[model samples]
Target: MQIELLVFIVMLGAFLLGNFLLKLPVSISMIMGAVLGALVAGEGFPLRHLFEGTFVYIDTILIISTAMIFMKVIEKSGAMEALNVTIVKRFHKIPAVMLIMLMLMIMFPGMITGSSTAAVLSAGSIVAPVLLLMGIPAPQTGAILAIGSIMGMAAPPVNIPAMLIAGGVDMPYIGFEGPLLFLTIPGAIFTVLFIGMRYCKNLNYDEIIKNLNFNMNAKHGFKLYLPILTVLTLMVLTRVLPTAIPNLGMPLIFMLGSIVGMFTGEKLDFISTVKDAMNTTVPVLGKLMGVGMFIQIMTLTGVRGYIVISCLGLSTVLLYVAIATVMPAFGAVSSYGAASVLGVPFLLALLSGNQIIVAAALSFICSLGDLMPPTALAGNYAAQIVNERYFKVLRYCLIPFTACIIFGIICLIYSKNLSFLV
Candidate 1:
């Protein structure tokens, strides 16, 4: 009968009702949840808290918006296509290596945008025909894209889930690159090899090449990739040189890359590309805003404190079990929601471990929610790209998905030992 627990239930019920019954966008559902939770707690709308919550992820919104614009530039400019073709051409003889490289390529946009849907739609679309040509089953190909895209969403430089958890705990979004790269790079390699390597062993260079969009590579060659290189170089320079180069934040960095991209490949209609990018990005930006409001309300109503305290009472064993199971299951709503709702409290519960590493691992686990049903954004899109039912893809993902959860738990348990990553 605790008011905090009641408020939490009301919010969750409202979210599910809005999301499932009303078929509202996840962001809008979250807003409904927030509004209802406030009402239940007798906070009476609290416009100030709701508006304040929206700004919680303002920086993340900027980064994702600009990053999507950058992704659109690369896609439109032929940079993405050229890179995909180049990778296959270079590594096709070694099917396993080629598959791994292609998987990493699929992860690229998600890594930048912190969205598995971005990865699945952008790189996954391009890679699907190649995988099919390599003789991988459609279901497995979908699984590969789903898993890789999720890993990319969990990767460093723009991990939204990690940012949410860190923000929840008042931790700065620094020192995460090492832990995130540690988890995602190896995780991506494993998922690709596990799902696609055996099927890809019998190489089909001729067919894959036939399907490859080679026009971009032939037209612009290396220049087609300059924008990607420019952004990566800037990222590295800002990190490696620190004082030498100004730290252009992710938004500025992405914008700089987009600007450089305009001249390096096929010409782009600047206004259309920007408009298209914004159109695609607005929903996700709205989701983050909703998450901010949802969490802000949770904090205001003592629901956040209730969850944290409840978690603190559990044994470590139960904590890990809940994290591995419930966290991903929550992704049916939205992975970002799972992070803000559960990941923060879990991180607090596991404070005995290294925070950055634990946060990274938690984010990885939360990213699996993108593969969960209904709103399985990555899985659904990946399935569509490969012409497979998402359930079939989910069946194929069983082993790799379990492995990822296990690896994430291992990261959580031995976080201090893995401090070398930081």
Candidate 2:
């Protein structure tokens, strides 16, 4: 075996052993993988290289951390809830419209958090009971929230997979919004309308609307919403004006947004919210740093290069098939993990004449990992909220999940010619 391949196998074994045998946390398991690779590769177990690897993805780590904090603050401040309630009131009379809105609302949390689990626990939980009462089958309803959250996580503004893929090539975050929006918007519509279609027919549209009449009283609803608006406006300004506004970047933008969020209705308890934010943020950041170490080992050992060259050896047809197959399957572990581990190699191997669409397509595929099993974060969380088994939820997710992969493949096949989309 190639030295890189040998090290990779050993590291993977270390990861599994640490997780299953020693019962270590994911971050610690990854560190153990790094240690194993170092031992086998004759790196002499240098702490410097390990620390170096951990900081390789520092920018993404910061973004993920700050964004999680911003999300926690928004959730705690009652802004997200207020926003959800506000959206419900507009279309409560029209059941299908309300469902559409509800799906979008669920997606928003994921879009903002770049986490399907957050969406499921936040908006998905909020809507589950409502949808259940509408007589939607538990499986289909779970599927709806799953698809929506997946697409939302893959959506433009803060897509972690996109950031990872783009970082591989040193691409700027600009211009992803357009291609990603194209991928996710169509996904949201197709899944909701199709998966939700059956559930809509039996729902008493008028009755659901009447019950959605509950309104939240914010001191100033618009002012309460200013933080979200600030974040969006700053994002757009950075993209459109570029040089006009100093680019504070995502972390700073998130921090600023969190600050503005404090003034929202029922002033959020800052200490508790920050404590809550850090509670969730630290673990994710730790896992990311661990992945960074794994990636660093790959870089040092030429494993990433080996993988890229291996992909390059394959025919175009085989390459796409393999890429599509492995991405979602690996998602059973973690989407970000799949994206960073495979996406970089794919980026090197599959240069389809157009960089933007390929990146977007890859990110879209990786995002759907939430629909697959084992970890099936989005589906399991949605299933829990709906009181259904995850596999049952996955059963309903099959068509839409598979459909997204096919759609992404088609997009890749035509990526070069789809510049009109951007």
Q: Write the per-residue lDDT of candidate 1 for residues 19-73, one digit (tens) a residue.
A: 8999998899999999999999999989999999999999999999999999999
TM accuracy, model 2: 0.94
In model 2, which runs have C-alpha deviations exceeding 4 angstroms? 20-22, 205-215, 218-220
Model 2 lDDT-worst window of ten: 211-220
Clashes of each: 0, 1
Model 1 worst lDDT run, 10 consecutive residues: 198-207
Instruction: List model 2 lDDT by residue over 1-422, tens digit each.
Output: 89988988888788878866787876788889888888898886868878997897788778777877788777776676676667656665576677778788888877877878777877787777667767788888888988999988998787888888888788876678888988998888888888876666656656655654244444455676778888999988987798888888899999999999887655678888878877866766777788888878877777778877887898888989987899888786568778888987787776755787888889999999877776577888888888789888888788888888999999888888888767
Best by lDDT: 1
